[model samples]
Target chain A: MSNWQWFHRLGSPRWFYYKTEGWVPWLAAVSGILLVLGTVWGLAFAPPDYQQGNSYRIIYLHVPAAFLALIGYYVMAVAGAVGMIWRMKMAFVVMKSAAPIGAALTFLSLVTGAIWGKPTWGTWWEWDARITSMLILLFLYLGIMALQAAFQSRDAADKASALLALIGTVNIPIIYKSVDWWHTLHQPATLKLTSAPTIHSSMLYPLLTMILAFYIFYALVLILYTRAEILRREGRTQWVIDLVKEEAKKP
Target chain B: MHPVRRQRLFFILFIVFFSSVAVGLMAFALRDNINLFYPPSMIVAGEVPLDRRIRAGGCVRPGSVSRDRETLETTFLLTDGIVDFRVHYTGILPDLFAEGEAAVVNGELRADGGFYATQVLAKHDEKYMPPEVAETMAAVSDGHDESCEVVQYGS
Candidate 1:
C-alpha cells in the first residue's frame, strides 16, 4: 500500500482497532518480560553507587518513568498535530489515549525522584528548576485530561486538548535542560547522547534496558487504551456490535 | 495551492505562535521566582540579601566538618575552590554527604556572617547502590555475603 493510502485507512476507527488488536498481546508479553528483567538486573546485578548506597536502585524505575513522561507529551502533541492537519481519527485516538499514561508516568517520576531525594538531596522536595518544570508538566497532563472531559462532544474535546498538548510541548525542553540552565541542587545529566555517559557500563546497560522496556510498555498500554477508546466512540456502529457478538459467541 | 489549504496552513502557524507566546509568559514569570539560590562565590561577594532565606552550595571542604558531641550540631566550611563560607546545621546530614563532596545548604544568613543552615543536601552527585553483590537479597539471606563491597570507582 502507498504511504498516504495507509494514512487514509487509519482514519477508520474499526480498521485501527482491528489492526492493533493482534499487536497488543505480543507487545504486552515483551514489555512485561523486559521490565522484569531490567528491574532485576538493575536492582540486583548492577553495582551500587560508591556514594548513595542502596537507595540509587530507584533509578531503574525513576529514569524510565521520567523518560516516558516527556516522550509521551511529544507523542500526544504530534498525534494531535496530525489529527488537526489531516483530520485522522486514529491520530486523535492516539492523542487521547496518551494523556492518562503521560500523567501517570509524570506522577511516578516526581514521587520516585522525591523518594530518591530524601537520602541524597536531604530534602523531600526542592523548588529546583528541574523539579519545578516537572511539576508544570504534570499540570499540563492533568489539564489536558480535564479539558478532554469537560467538552460535551468528542470533536471539541479532541481539538481543545490537542491545542493544550501543543502548548505543553514547549515545557519538555525546559524540563530536560533545567539543570544546565539553572544552578540548582540537582546535578548535571549523567547520560548524554552526544558524549560518553558518566555512569559505568554495568549500571548504564540496565538503565538503558529499562528505558527500552518503558517505551515498549508505553506503546502496549497506549494500544490497550486506544482500543477501549475506539470501542467507546464507536459503540453504536455495526462493527462494534458485530465484534461484541463475535466475542460473546466465542465464549 | 487552494485557498482552503492555505487557510489550514495559516491555522497551524497560529497554533505555534500561540504556544510560543504562552511559554514565553511562563518563562518570564519563572525568572524572578526561581533565581532564589546563589552560588558560594556570589554569596561571598555579598550578592545575596541578608536576613532572607537563601540557598548556597559548594564542596564540603576537607577536614572542615566538625560536630559537637552533646548538641549533635555539625559545622562545615562550604567552598567553591575560590571563595569559602561556613555552614552550620543542627541535624543529621544526608547519607551521601561527606568531606570534599558537593553540597547545598539552605538557611538564613545571620548578622554574624555565618549561615545558620536549616537543611543540607549532598546536591551534585547521587551515589548509587552497590553492584558487586550481583545476586538478589536471597543471596544475603542464604548467608553468601554480609553486604555488597565497593569496587574501583571511576568518578
Candidate 2:
C-alpha cells in the first residue's frame, strides 16, 4: 500500500505541480542538447544514403516526430482512461494537455514526410495506406482537441473527450500495421523491435538519440502544460491561492 | 480498488475492445482496395480488370530499361520475381528510379499487357547504407541479386 502511495499522490494537482516544478529546466536542457547533437551528426557526419543521398537525413526529424505522435496518443488515452475510471482530476488535465502537442507532432511528421517524398517518391502526396493512416491519426488528435473545446461544462467536456480518446486508440494499431497490411508507396519500417536495424550504425545511432530526445521533449512539454492546467483549474483552492501569493511575495 | 472504480475500468476496457473489433472487421473486408497497387503476378493472372486506371508495383528488372532519348518515352520491365511486365512512361523519372529498384506505376493496361503509365514513382527498400558499403557489398556478392528479394507484393 505504501508503495502505491505515490500513485494516489500523483492525482493531486498540488503534489504533481511541485514535483515537476524543478524538472522543467533540466529536461529542456537535456532535450535541447540531444536535439542539436543528433541533428548535426545526422546532417554532417552520417554518410549519404547509397540510393537516396542526403535527403535521407530528414529521417532524424520525421521518424522521431512520427514515433512520438503515435506514442503521445496512447499516453493521452491512458490518462483519459485513468481519469474516467478513478475520477482523477490530474489525469484529466494531463489528457487535456496532450492533445495539441500530439497534433503538432503529427502535423510535423506529415509535413516532413511530404518534403521527403517529393524527391524520393516523385510525388508530394500519395493515397497509399501508410500515408492515409498517418493523416487519419492527425485528424484523431484534432477531433479529441475539438471535443474538449466543444462542451460547455468542464466535467462534461472531460468525460466526452475521454470517451473519444479511448475510441480513437483503434487507429494506433492500424497506423502501425498499414505498411505491412497493404501495398504502400512508403517503405517498410527501417527499424524493427525484433531485429537489428536495417540502417548502418552511423545512421542508426543518431536516429536513436533523436528518438530519445523527442520522448524527453514530449514529457517536458506535457508536464509544463499539465502544471498550467492545474493552476487554472485549481485557482480557487486555498493551496493554489497560497502558492500564488507566496510566489507574488518573492522578489 | 473501489467497487465503482473497478466497474468503470471494466467498462472502459469493454468499450475499447469492441471498437477495435469493429474497426478490424471493416479493415479485413476492405483489404483489397486498401492496397496501393497490385503485383505483376495479379495482373498476369488476368485478375485485374481492363480499361480502368489501376496501379502495379514491382522491382525494375535489370537490363530491361530502354529510352527513346529524344522524347521522355521510356520503357522498363517490372517484376515480382514470379511474374514480369513492362511499364511505359513519358515523363522525367525520380532521382532514385533505376534498374533493380522498386517502382509503382499508375495508368492503364495495354492490350499487349504492357502498362502505359501516366505517373511513375520510385519505391525504395528499408535498407540504408553509404555508397562505399554498397560498393563493398556489390563486390562481395558479385552477380548475386539482393535488391529484388527485399520487396514483397501484397497478397
Candidate 3:
C-alpha cells in the first residue's frame, strides 16, 4: 500500500478500533510490569540522597508526573492543530481525550511537589515562580476540559477547545523556564539532555525506566480513550452495528 | 489562498494576537507583585528598599549562627560569599536547615540592616539548593554546593 493509503486508513475509526484490540493487552502488560519494577527499584532499592534522606524518594512519582504533565500540553496542542488544520475526526478525538488525563497528571505533580516541599521548605505552598507557573498549567487543563463541556454542539466544542489549546501553548515554555527566569523555591532540573544527568546511576536508571514507562502508559491509555470516544460518536454507523452483531454471534 | 487555508491562517493570527496581549497583562501584574527576592550582595550595594516586604537569600555563613536559650529565637548571617548580612528569625526552622547549605529568608530589612525574618526556608535537603539562593551565589561566582554543581546553569 502507498504511504498516503496507510495514512488515510489511520483516520478510519473502524480500522483503528479493530486494529487496536490486539495491541491494548500487550501495552497494558508492559506498562504494569515496568511500573512495578520501577516503583520497587526507586522506593526500596535505590540509595537515599545524602541530603534529603528518604524524603527524596518522592522524586520517583513527582518527577515522572511533572515531566509527563509538560509533554501532555504539547501533545494536546499538536493534536488540536492537526484536528483544526486537517479537519480530521480522529485528531479531535485524540485532542479531547488528552485533557482530563493531563489535568490529573498536573494535579498529581502539584500535590506531590507540596508533600515533598513540606519537610524541606518548611511550608506547603509558596507563590514562587515555578510553583505559580505549574498552577497555571493545571488551570489550563481544567479550562480546556470545562470549555469543551460548556458547548451544546459537539462540533462547536471541538473547534473552541482547539483554539484554547493553541492559545495556551505559550505557557509551556514559561513553566519549563520559571526556575531560570525568576527566583523560586523549586530546585533545578536533575535530567538534562544537553549535559550529563545530575543524579547517580543507581537513581537515574530507575527514573529513566519510570519515565519511559509513563510514556508507554500514556500511549496505552490514550489509545483506550480514543477507542471509547470513537465508539460513542460512531454508534449509529453500520460497521459498529455489524461489529456488535459479530461479537454477539461469536458468543 | 483557498478558503479553508484562509480560515486556518486567521486562527493562527488570532492565537498570536491573544497570546501577546495575555502575556503582557501577566507581565504587568508580575512586575507589581514580583519582588523575586534580593541577594545579600544587592543589600551590600545598598540597593534594597527597607519599606515594603522583600526577600533575601543565600547560604547560612558557617560559624555565624546563634540562638537565645530562653526565647528559642535564632540569629545568623546569610551570605553569598561576597556579601554577608544578618537574619533574626523567631519561628522554628525546618529540619534540613544547616550551615553551608543554601536557604531563603523572607522578611523586612531592619534599620540596623539586619533581616527581621518571619519565615526562614532552609535548604530542603543537604543536596538541594533552592534555585533562588543558588542564583544569589552564582552572582558572586562561588555558585554551588553538591546539588547544583552538576547542573548547567542556562539552556
Q: Report the number of the highest-DockQ candidate.
A: 2
Residue A108's lDDT in candidate 3? 92
TM-score of each: 0.89, 0.96, 0.88
Task: Identify the runs in model 1 with alpha carbons over 4 angstroms from their true place.
Answer: B1-6, B25-32, B126-155
Worst 10 residues of 1 chain B by lDDT: B143-152
Under CAPRI classification, how is model 1 graded?
Answer: acceptable
Report the lDDT tens digits of candidate 1 across residue range A147-168. 9889999899999988888877
DockQ of 3: 0.30
Clashing pairs in 3: none
The CA lDDT of each predicted structure is: 0.81, 0.91, 0.80
Tens digits of per-residue lDDT for model 1, B1-155: 45774676578778777887887787778774665367777778887789888888777776789999999999988776667788889998887787766778889887777899998887645323344532353365321111111111122
TM-score preference between candidates 1 and 2, better one: 2
Error of 2 at B119 (Å): 0.6
Best by TM-score: 2
Q: lDDT winner among the candidates?
A: 2
Compose the digit string of candidate 2's lDDT tens values, residues A1-251. 99989999998899999989999999999999999999999999999998889999999999999999999999999999999998988999999999999999999999999999999999999899899989998998899889888988999999999999999999998988888889999988888888888898878999999999999999999999998999999999999989999999999
Residue A236 alpha-carbon offset, candidate 1, angstroms: 1.7
Question: What is the DockQ ranking, best to worst?
Answer: 2, 1, 3
Model 3 residue A17 distance off true place after TM-score fit, in angstroms: 1.3
Mind giving the per-residue lDDT tens digits that candidate 2 earns over B1-155?
89999999999999999999999999899998999999989988888978799999989887889999799799998988768888899999999888878899999987788889999999987788888888898876432224475544333
For model 1 chain A, the run of ten residues with the poorest summed lDDT:
A180-189
